[model samples]
Target chain A: MAKYLLLKHYRGAPAAVNDVPMDQWTPEEISAHVQYMNDFAARLEGTGEFVDAQALAPEGRWVRYDGEGRPPVTDGPFAETKDLIAGWMVIDVDSYERAVELAGELSAAPGAGGKPIHEWLEVRPFLTAPPTITE
Target chain B: MDEALLRSLTPSVLGILVRRGADFAAAEDAVQDALVEAVRVWPADPPRDPKGWLVTVAWRRFLDATRADAARRRREDLVDEEPAPGPAPAVDDTLQLYFLCAHPSLTPSSAVALTLRAVGGLTTRQIAQAYLVPEATMAQRISRAKRTVSGVRFDQPGDVATVLRVLYLVFNEGYSGDVDLAAEAIRLTRQLAAAIDHPEVAGLLALMLLHHARRATRTAPDGSLVPLAEQDRGRWDTASIAEGVEILQAALARDRLGEFQAQAAIAALHADAPTAEETDWVQIVEWYDELVRLTDSPVVRLNRAVAVGEADGPRAGLAALAALDDSLPRHAAVAAYLHERDGDLATAARLYAEAARKAPNLAERDHLTRQAARLNARRCR
Candidate 1:
C-alpha cells in the first residue's frame, strides 16, 4: 500500500464554497464539524487506512544560515497573506483513486450551518524506499 | 532454557498443530502461547523431550480454543475422533509451513512478516521493533496478513523463487533494533536448504554469505558509505568467504545455472581478489554476461556496464551505458564516475550534483554530495 498526505491549509488556498471561518461558525456547527472529523479518522482505522494525523499552530518563522561562527538569521511570523498549513492526515491505501476519494470525504467536513465545507485539500505521496528486487 | 533450540523447534511444533486439523492462524497463536509458557517454565523444569513438550502444550491450547468456539464444537468432536499422525510425519510438515507462509496471495511485506513469525519463531514485538513500527500497528498488519492467507490449503507446491525473494528482502534490511535480520535471513535460508534439495536455494545462501562477509567494511566508523573499490580488504571475513565459495562450487556443479548462482559467482570473483587492483574484471564481466542471459533485467545490464568499464576502459563503459534509459536509478552516478575517469572534470562534477539530488538513501546522497564538492574544489585549485 502507498501512503498519501491530505493537507488542510489556513491560507494561500482558493476560497471554499462555505467560506466561513471556524470562529465564525455557531457552537453547534463547530461541534458537528469536530465530530465529523473524529468519525472519519475512526472509520479509516477500522478500514486499516489510517496511519497518522496532526494539527499545527498557525504561527511559524524562517531561519537561514549565516557567515561562519555567527548565529543563524531568523525571521518573524509573516502577515496573514502568507501560506500557512493548518494540519494534515496521512493514510495508507490500496490505490491513488481510493486516496483521492478519502481526501474528498475529509474535505466535506461540516462547516457553518452544518453544511459541507468543500475546502480544498492538497494530497501528496510519500517517496518510498527502493524495493530490494529492482530486477 | 536453550533459546535457539526452542526457536528452531517452533515451526515443527506449529506444523504438528496445523496437521492435526487446527486452522493456520489459530495454530500459530497456540504455538506462541506454548512458547510463552516454555519461557516461563523451562528454566527450572526442562523437559527431556523439548519437541514433545511443545507439541503437547500447543495442541492442548488449540483444542481449548476450538472447544470455546461453540460453532466448531461438532466439528471438533469429529476431528477428535481421528488419531493424530505419528511424530516424524508431523515434523516433516515444516516445509509445507514455509510454502503456506510464502503463499502467492500475500503481498511481499506480508509474506516476509508471516515467515519471520511462523517459521523463524520471532515474537511480534521483536519484528515490530526491527521494522521500526509501532507495536500495535505491526500487530494489525500481521493479523490482517493472517486473515488474508487463512483460506489457502497446504497441499499445493510453492514457488521456491518467491521464498528466496522474501528472504533476500529480509537480509537487505540488515541490522535494526535488537534483531539482526540479515543473520536471521541466513538462518531461515539454511533451514530451507535443509528441507529442499534445490541448487537455487544453495545459491541464495552463498550469495548472502558472500555479501555479509563484506558488510563490516562497507561503511566507515562515521557511517559514511564506502565504495566497493575503496573498502579495506584486510577486514573481510575469510571464513565466510571460504564457506560461500565452497557452497557456490557445489551449486555450479549441478548445472542448473540460476540467477542467484550467477550473481554469487560475481561476488566470489570480487572476494577472490587479493587487492582491488588484482580483481579479475574480465572474469567478472564474463559472469555478468552469464547473469544477463539468466535474467535480462535492466539493473543487471547497468551493473554489467560498470564491470565492462573496469575490464575495458571508461569509453567502452560509457558506450555500453548509452543503450540504456538515462532515467534509471544510479545512471547519472555511473556516468559521473566514467566521465571523471575520462578527464571530463566539469561534466563529472555537474553529474555528481544531479545524482546527489536523486539519490534514494541518505548515505548515498551524502556520498554523492561529497564527490561533487571534491571535484568542484579540485577545479578551483
Candidate 2:
C-alpha cells in the first residue's frame, strides 16, 4: 500500500467553487462542513486507510542555525500572511487511483450553504522504504 | 523452562488443533492458554516432550472451550475423530500455518500481526508494545486477521512470496519494546526454510542472516545511524556471516536465481570484505544488475546506482542516476553521497539538508541533518 498526503491550503491554492469564508457561512453550514470533514476521516479510519490528520495554526517563524555561542536566528515574516497550509490528512491506500478518489471525496466537504467546496487539494505520495524483494 | 523452546512449538501445535477441526480463532486461543499453562507449571515439573505436552494441553483447552459454548457445536461433529495425541502427525503443519497467516485476503499489517501472534507466538500485548499500538488496537487487528483467514481450508496451497514478504517486514522493524523483531523474523524464516524446498525461501533466509550479521554495528551506542562503509567490520558477527554465506552458496547452486538470492549475493559480497576498500563492488554491481532485471523496481535501480558509483566512479554513478526519478526515497541521500565523493561538498551539503527535511522517519532525518551540519562546519574552516 502507498501513503498519500492530502493537503488543504489556507490561501495558496486556487479558489474553490464554493469559496465563501468560514466566518461568513451560516453557522449550520459551518457545522455541516465540520461534520463532513470528521465523517470523511472516520470513514477512512474504518477502511484502515487513515494514517494521520492534523490542522496547522498557520502562524510560525523561520529559525536557522547561527554561529556557535550565539542564539539561533529567527526572522521570517508572519507565516499567516503567506499562503499557508490549513490542514492535511495522510492516508495509506491500495493504489494511486484510490488515493486520488479519497482526496476528491475529502475536497468535496460541504462549504458555504452546505454545498460541495470543489477545492483543489494537493495529493502527494510518501516515499516508501525499499522492499526486501524487488525482483 | 526455556521460553523460546515453548514459543517454537506454538505454530505446529496450533496447526494440529486446526487440522483436527478446531476453528482457527479457537485453536489460537487454546494454544495461548496452553502456553500460559506451560509457563506456570513447567518450572516446577518440566515435560519430557514439550510439543506433545502442549498439544495435549491445548487440545483439551479447545474441547473445553467448544463444550462451554453452545454456538460452537460445529466442533461436536469432530469429537469422534479426536486425535489420540502423543505427538503431532509426522506431517509438518507449520508451513500451512505460515500460508494461512499470510493469506491474500488480509492486508499487510493484518498479515504481519497474525503471523506474529499465531506463527511467531507473540502475545497481543507484546506485539502491541513492539508496534507501538495500544493493546486493544492490536487485539482487534489480530482478531480481524484471524477472522479473515478462518474460511480458508487448512490444506490449500499458499504463495511463498507473500509469506516471505511478511517475514521481511518483521525483520525490518528491528527492535522495539522488549521484542527483537529482527531476531524473531530470522527465527521464522529459518523455520520456513526448513519446511520448504524453494530456493527463494533459502535466499530470503540468507539475506536476513547476512543483514543481521552486521546489525550490531549498523548504529552507534547512542542510537545514531552509521553508514555501512563507516561501520566497524570487527564488530560484525563472524558466525552469522559464515552461516549466511554458506546458505547463499547452497541457494545459488539451485540456479533458480530469484530476487532474494540476488540480494543475498550483494549482502554476501559486503560481508566478504575485510575492509570497505576490499569490497568487490564489481560483483556487487552485477548482483544489483540481476536484481534490476528481476524486479525492475525503481528502488532497486536507485540502489544499483550506488553500487555503480562504488564499482565505476562517482561520475558514472551520477550518469546512471540520471535515468531515475528524483522523487524516489533515498534518491537525494544517494545523490548527496555521490556528490561528496565527486568533491562537490556544497551541493552535497545542500542536498543532505533537503533530504533531511523530507525524511519520513526521525532517525534518517537526524542522520541526514548531521551530515549537512558536518559539511557546513567543514566549509566554515
Candidate 3:
C-alpha cells in the first residue's frame, strides 16, 4: 500500500470557500467540525487505512549551526510569510485514487453554518524505499 | 529464555495445529498464545522438547478457544480427532506458512506484517515498533491479512517469487526499534534456503550476506551516510563476505540464473574487489546488463548507468543515463555524481541540491545536502 500525507496549513494555503476563522464560528459549528474530522480518522482506522494523524503548534523556528561550538542561529516564527503547517494525517491506502478521494472528503469538513469549508489541503505522496528487486 | 529457539519453532508448531484441523487464524492465535506462555514459563522451567511442547500447548489452546466460541461448532468434528502429543513429524510446513503469509490477495504491507507475525514469529508490538505504526494498527493489519488467507487451502503450491519478494521487502526495511529487520530477513532467507533447493533462494541469501557484511561501515559515528568508496574496508566482515562469495559461486555454477542470482553476482563482484578503485565495474556492468535483460526495470537501468560510469568514464556514464527517464528515483543523485566525476562542479552542485530535496528518506536527504554543500564550498574556495 502507498502512504500519502494530507497536510493542513495554518497560514500558507489559499483561502477556504467558507473563509470564516475557527474563532469566529459558533461553538456548535466548531464542535461539529471537530467531530467530523475525528469521525473521518476513525472511519479510516476501521478500514485499516489510517497510519497516524497529528496537530502541530503554530510556533516554529529555523535553526542553523553557526560554528562547531556556537549555540546556533535561530530565526523567527515567520507568522505571516512562512508556510506554517497546522497538522497532517497520514493514510496508507491501496491506490492514488483512494488517497485523492479521501483527501476530497477531508476537504469537505464543515465550517461556519455547518457548510463545507472546501479548504485547500495539500496532498503529498511519501517517497518509499526502493524495492529489493531493483538491485 | 532462548527467543531465537522459540521463534524458530513457531511456524512448525502453528503448522502442526493447522494440519490437525485448526483453521489458520485460530491456529495462529493459539501459536501466539503458546509463544507468550513460553516466554513467561520457559525462563524458570525449560522444556525437554521445545517444539513438541509448543505443539501440544498451542493445540490445546486452539481447542480451548474453539470450544469457548459458540459459533465455532462447525469445527468440532475436526477437533475431535486430536493426535497424541509427541515429537512433531519432520514434515516442515513452514514453507507453506511462508506462501500463505505472502498470499497474493494481501497487500504488500499486509503480507509483510503477516509474514513477520506468522512466519517470522515477531509479536504484533514488535512489528508495530519496527514499522513505526501503532500496535493496534499493526494488529488490525495482521488480522486482516490472516483473514484474507484463511480461505485458501494449505495444500496449494505457492509462488516462490512472491515469498522471496516479501522477504526482500522485510530486508530492505533495514533496522528500527528493537528489531534488526535485515538480520531477521537474512535468517528467514537462510531458513528458506534450507527448506528449498532453489538457486535463487541461495542467491538471495548470498546477496543479503554480502550486503550485511559491509553494514557496519556504511555509516559514520555521527550517523551520517558513508558512500561505498569512502567506507573502511578493513572493518568489513570478511567471514560474511567469504560465505556470500562461496554461495554465489555455487549458484552461478548451476547456470539457471534468476534475477536474485544475477544481483548476487553483482554484489559478489563488489565484495571480491580489494578496494573501491579496484572494483570490477566491467563485470558489475555485465551483471547489470543481465539484470536489465531479466527484469527490464527502469530502476535497474538507472543503476546500470552508475556502473557504466565507473567502468568506462563519467562521459560514458552520462551518455548511458541520457537514455533513461529522468524522473526515476535517484536519477538526480546519479547525474550529480557523474557530473562531479566529469569535473562539472557547477552542474553537480545544483543537481546535488535538487536530489537532496527529492530524497526519499532523511538519511539520504542529509547525505545529498552535504554533497551539495561540499561542492558549493569547493567552488567558493
Candidate 4:
C-alpha cells in the first residue's frame, strides 16, 4: 500500500463547479458537508486506510533567519498571491486508483445548494524511504 | 529478566505450538501471553528450562483458549493430543516461522509487521512505535497477516529470496523507539544462516554487517548525511568489517554467487581501503558488473556508473550514465557528483539543485542543497 495526501486548497486551485463560498451556503448544507467528510474518513478508518486528517487556518506567514543571534524576520500572509491550503487528508490505500476514488468522493461533499462541489483536490504521493537494496 | 533471551526463544516456542496443531494466530497470541507472563514471573521465579517452560505455558494457554471457545470444541480432540514437550527441532521450526511470516500472500508492510512480531519477537506496540504508526493499526496489520497465512501448510518449503527481502527491509528501517531493527535484522539473518546453508544468506549477513559497521560515521552529530567518501574511516567498526570480510570470502569461495554476495564483495572492497582515495574502484566496478548481470536492475547500473567515474574518469562515468533512463531515482544526484568531479561547476551546481528537489528523504535533500549552495558560493567568489 502507498500513502497519498488529498489536499483541499483554499485559494490556488481552479474554481469548483458549485463555486459558492462556504459562508454563502445554508447552515444545513454546511452541516451536511462536514458530516459527509467525517463519514468518509470514518469509513476509511474502518477499512484501515486512514492515516490522518488535519485542517489549516488560512492565515500564515513566511519567516526567515536574520542572523545567528538575531530574531527571525516575518513577512505578510500574502493571501492574494499565496496558494493557501485549507486542509489535507492522508490515506494509505491499496492502489493509486483507490486514492483517486476516495479523493473523488471527498470532492463530492454537499455545497451551497446541496450540490456536489466537485472541487479540484490535489493528490500527491509521498516519497518513501529508500529501500535497503538501493546501492 | 533477560529480554533478549525471551525474544530469542519466541520463534521456536511459537513454532512448536503451531506444529502441535494450534492455529497460527492463536498460537502467536498464546506465545505473546506466555512472554508477558514470563516477564512478570521470571524476575522472582526464573525457570531452569526456559524453552520448555515457555512451550508448556504457551501450549496450556492455547488449549485453555480453545476449550473456552464452545464453538471450537471440534479442536478439543487435537488439543487433547498434546505432543510431549522435549527437545524440539528448533532449526526447522524457526525457518518455517520465517517463511510463514514472509508469506507471498501478504502485502510487504503486513509481511514486515508479522515478521517483526512473530519471527523477531517484538511486541505490536514496539513495532508501531518503530513505524510511527498507532498501536491499533499495527495490531490490525499483524492479525490480518496471520489470518492470511493461516491456511498455508506449515511444512511447505519457502523461497529463500522472499525471506531475505523481508530481513533486508527490517535492516533498512534502522533504529526507532526501543528496538534497534538493524541489529534485530542481523540477529534474524544470522539465525537464518545457521538454519540454512545458502551462500546468499551469508552474503546478506555480510552486507548488513559491513553497512552497519559504518552506521555511526554515516551521519554527523547534527543529523546531517555524511557522504561515504567523507566519512571518518577511523571511527568504523573494525570487528564488524573483519567479520563481514571473512564471511564474504567464504561465500565467494562457494562459487554460487548471488546478488547479495556480489553486493557484499563491493562493500568489502570499500571496507578494505584505509582511505577513500585508496579505494579499489576498478575491482568495485567489476563487482558492479557482476551485480548488473545478476539483477540487471537500473539501480545497479546507476551505481556502476559511479564506480566507473572513480575507476576511469568522470567522462566515462557520464557515458555509462547516459545509457540509463533519466527517470530513475538519484540519477540527477549521480550526474551532479560526476559533473563536480569533472570540474564543470555550473552544470554540477544546477544538477545538484535539481537532485535536491527530487530527493527521496530529508537528509539526502539537505545534502544535495548544500552541495548546490557550495558550488554557487564558489562561483560568486
Candidate 5:
C-alpha cells in the first residue's frame, strides 16, 4: 500500500524550535545534517517506490492572485499557527511498518542546534478512488 | 445456441479457469471472453454437459493469455501449477474465487469488478455499461489492482470485511438501466452470506433486503424523491421486511454488534413502522448512535442527525449538523434536508441547489434541483 507523510513540528511546534539561535551550532554540523537528509532521500529515490517528497518553507504568506497587477499579499516569519503543516510526501511502500521506519529516519535529521529534534510526524493512509474500467 | 444451457454453465467455466492457476481477476476476464464466444457459437450445437464444455474452452483462453504476458512471471512457470481437475472440482471453487476477488489490497472498485466478473458471471461490457465509465479505464483499474496484489499469497484465506465491502459496493451501484445492479448485489451478497456464516454477513443481507424493500416507494410517480415521511407504506415489501427482521433478530441475539448489525437495527426499526408518523425514531437514533461508536464515519454522523431530527425536532438535527465538518460530501445536502424540515424554505432551497451541483450522479442532481424548484414554486403560490 502507498503511504503518506504528515510533516509537522515535534517540541512545542516549529516556532518554538525555530526560536533556538542558529549561531550556537558549528557550521560543519549543519552541513552534515543537510547532507545526511539529501543522501537518505537519494537512497529512497533509487527505488521506484520513491513517489514524491519535498520540504515546505517554514514561512508561508496568503496572497490574492485574483487581482490584475501584482495581486495583493501579506507579510511573513509566518505566525506560529495551531495545526499548521510544513509539507508532505507520498511514497509507495510495501507496508505501514516500512513507512514508519522511513519517517523515523527523516525525523532524526539534525537541526541547527546540532541535535535531532525528531519531530513527531503523523502518518495517514491515502484512500484512492475506484479505478475506471476500460474495454 | 441454447441460452439456458450457457447460463447454467457460467459458474463452472469460472471454476475451471480459477483452478488452472488464473487469479480471480484473470479467471473472470478469460471466462467472460469464452462466454461471449459461447453466446455467438453454442446455439448451433449444444454440447452434453455444457458446463464441462465451457470449462475446457475458458481454461485454454486463460492459459494462452498467461503465457503471452511478458512482464508477469507466468503461473505456468511455477513447477507445481495444478492441472485442471475433471468437471466439478472437489474444492469449493466459487468460495475460493470470492476470497481472491476480495483480496485486501485491491480497492473497493477493483474488488467489485473482480467479484461481479468472477462470481456474478458478467461480461466486461455489462460491468462497463453498468457503471457508465469508459471500459478502458475500468480495465486498467482492474489490471493495476490485479498487478498490485500479484505478490499477495492467494492460498491464504481472506478477511471477511473485505469480502463484505466488495458486495456492498455492488449493491450501492443502484440500477441505472436494465442491469438492476442493486438486485445483482443482493444476489451476490446472498451467495456470500451462504458461503460464510458471519453474523455481520447475515446482518448485511438483512440490511440490503430491508432497504430494497422500500426502494420502490423512495421515488414518487413523477420520479422525484419521495421523502420517507411521504412514502406509501403499503408499497413496501412485507415479505422482505419480515425476512430482514427475522435475520436481524437472529444476528442481534449473538451479542456481536458490528457495523452491519447496527445498520440492520436501524433498518429493522424502519421496517416495523406502518406509517412514517409511527416510526420508532428514538430506537432508530439509538442504532445510529451505536453505528457512530462502531464506525465514526462522517456519513454515519449525517445519518444520525436525520434520526435525531426525526425523534426530537429539526433544530436538534441542525445542531448536530453544526458540529461536523462542513467539508463532508453530504453535509450541505443533509443541512438542506434539516432546514426544509425546520420550515426555512429559502435557506433549504439555496442549500438544495448547492447540493444538486455536487450530486454524484445526474439522477440525484435532477432530484435535488426539482426539490429546489418545487419549494420556489410553492413560495410564489
Candidate 6:
C-alpha cells in the first residue's frame, strides 16, 4: 500500500472557512464546523485507516547551533509559512492514487463556515524498508 | 499456522522473495498478502512447511501483480518463470534486508514500523497501538517510506548506523503491540551482529540485555513507571545481566569505544549496584563524559547533568542544566527535581507542572502531573 502524510494544522488541514476567514465566520457556523471535524475524526478513528493525528501550538521558533564563542539564539517561525503544520497523520493504503483519495476526504473535514474547508494538505509518502514474508 | 509460527517464518519467506528478484518494497507487500491469506487458509489446511508454503504463495501473488502492472513490466520480465520454486535464499539475504530497512534516509519511526511489519511479521494495527497512533497513519507512513526507498538499488550497501538505531528502538519499545517488539528487536539485532563485525552491534546487544534484564521490575505493582532507584533488585534477571555484562566487558576490552558501548556501560553500572546508595555515580558520570565526547547531543548532556548531580550535588546539576538549551524536552522536569533536592518546593512544583504540560506522551504527562500533585500535598501537610 502507498502511504501519504496528511498534514494537520489550523491552516494546513480543513478549516471550514477557506472562503471566509475563521474570524469572519458566524458563531453558529463555527460551532457547526467544530462539530463536523469532531465527528469526522471519530469516524476515521473507528476505521483501521487512521494512523495518527495531532494538533501543535502555533507558537514556534527557529533555531541554529551557535559557534564556540557565540551563544545560540532563537528566531521566530515567521518565514511566511501560511500553511505551517500543527500536526499530521501518516496513513498506509493500497496506492498513491488511494492516498490522494483519502487526502481528499480528510481535506473535506469541516471549517468555520459550515462547508468543506478543503484546506491545503501536504501528502508525503514514507520511505520503504526491507522486504517481509508477506510481501 | 499460529501467530507465533507466522512470526518465526516471516523473515525467511521475505528473504526468499528478495532472492527471487522482487525488490524489497514489493517483496514486503507480497509477503504480507500471503500471511493474510495464510490466516484465512491455515486453520482449515495447515501446511507442514509453513515457510515454503508462504514463500510459494506470496511469490505467485507478486508475479501476478507485477505482470498486471504497466510500470513494473521491465522488472517482472527479469523473473524467468512466474512461480518461484526454490530453497530459501541464503542467510545473507536476511542480513541484507536488515540493512535495507535501517537505511539512513528513513525516519526512526518509519524504520521501526517497516522492520516490525517486514521482519517481526506484525500487523499495521499492532504497530499503531504500540506507538499509540491510528493504524491508518502508520500504514501510510510505511507505504510512503517504501515508495521513497523503491528507487534505491538492492545491490548498493547502506549505512549500518541507521539499521542499529532502528533495531535499538525496537528493543527499547518493550513489547507494546501484538508482537513482542523487544524480542523481535533482539532476534533481528542478533542476526545483524552475526553478519557484521561492528563493535557497536555487540554493544547494542549488550545494552539491550542490560536494560532488558530489569524490564520485569521496570513497572510498579500498580503498573506505573518505577524509577530505577526504586526497582526491586531481587527481581532482576541475573542470567541476562551476566550475559550483558560479559558482552560489554568483551567489547570494552577491544578499546573501540562507541556511544552504544558507553550507554551499555552506564546500564551495566546500574545493574551492578546492589542499592541506590551504592550506585557508582562517579563512574557513571565518567562514562557520560565519554558519551558527550563521542556524541554532542543535547539529550546526552541533559542526562549527564543528572549524573553530575549524583556524582557531585544538586547545585552542580542545576549549574550544568543552566548551561543547556532551554527548549530541550524534560528540561523543566529535571530543573524541578534539582530544585526540590535544594529545598525549593514552590519553584519545583511550578516547574513540575510546566514539565507535565510539555510532556509528549500521556504516561509521562500523567507521571509528571502526579509528581506535582504529590509535592503540593506535602506542602499543604
Each candidate's iRMS in angstroms? 4.4, 5.2, 3.3, 3.1, 11.1, 12.2
* lDDT string, candidate 2, B1-381, tens digits: 799999999999998888788899999999999999999999999999999999999999987887777455554555556677665687779999999999999988788889998998999889877765556656777887888888899999999999998998888743356998888999999999989999999999999998988888877898777888898999999999999999999989978999989989999999899999999999989988899899998999999999899999999999999999999988999899899999999999999999898886666788899999999999999
TM-score of each: 0.87, 0.81, 0.90, 0.90, 0.65, 0.71
Candidate 5: segments with Cα more than 4 A from true spot: A1-135, B1-16, B20-29, B40-50, B60-87, B343-350, B373-381
Q: Over the stretch B1-381, how does candidate 3's per-residue lDDT look in tens digits?
A: 889989988888888888887899999999999999999999999999899889988989988888777355554555567788877887889999999999999888899889999988899999987876678777888888888898999979999999998898888864456998989999999988888889999999998999889888887898778888888999999999999999988998999899999988988887788899999999999999999999999999999999999999999999999999999989999999999999999999999999999997777889899999999999999
DockQ of 4: 0.33
Mind listing the fnat for each candidate?
0.05, 0.02, 0.33, 0.21, 0.00, 0.13
For TM-score, candidate 4 versus 6, the one ahead is 4
Top candidate on DockQ is 3
Error of 4 at B37 (Å): 2.0
Looking at model 4, residue B14 earns an lDDT score of 95
Q: Score candidate 2 by DockQ.
A: 0.13
Candidate whose TM-score is highest: 3
Residues A6-67 of candidate 2: C-alpha lDDT, one tens digit per residue: 99998899989988888999999988989998998777765656667899976768899899
**What DockQ does candidate 6 have relative to the true complex?**
0.08
> In model 2, where do residues sit more than 4 Å from their true spots?
A1-135, B71-86
Q: Quote model 5's iRMS.
A: 11.1
The alpha-carbon deviation from the true structure for residue B253 of candidate 2, after best TM-score superposition, in angstroms, is 1.8
Where's the lowest-lDDT run of ten residues in candidate 2 chain B? B70-79
* Model 6 agreement with the true structure over B195-225: per-residue lDDT tens digits: 7888898999998888778878876666566
Candidates' DockQ values? 0.24, 0.13, 0.36, 0.33, 0.02, 0.08
> What TM value does the first chain of each candidate achieve?
0.93, 0.92, 0.94, 0.95, 0.66, 0.72
| Cα distance off (Å), candidate 3, residue A21 | 4.8
- Sort every candidate by TM-score, greatest first: 3, 4, 1, 2, 6, 5
In candidate 4, which residue ranges exceed 4 Å CA deviation?
Answer: A1-3, A17-36, A46-49, A57-82, A92-117, A125-135, B71-91
Grade the docking of candidate 3. acceptable
> Chain B TM-score of model 6, please?
0.86
> In model 1, what are the clashing residue pairs, if there are any?
none
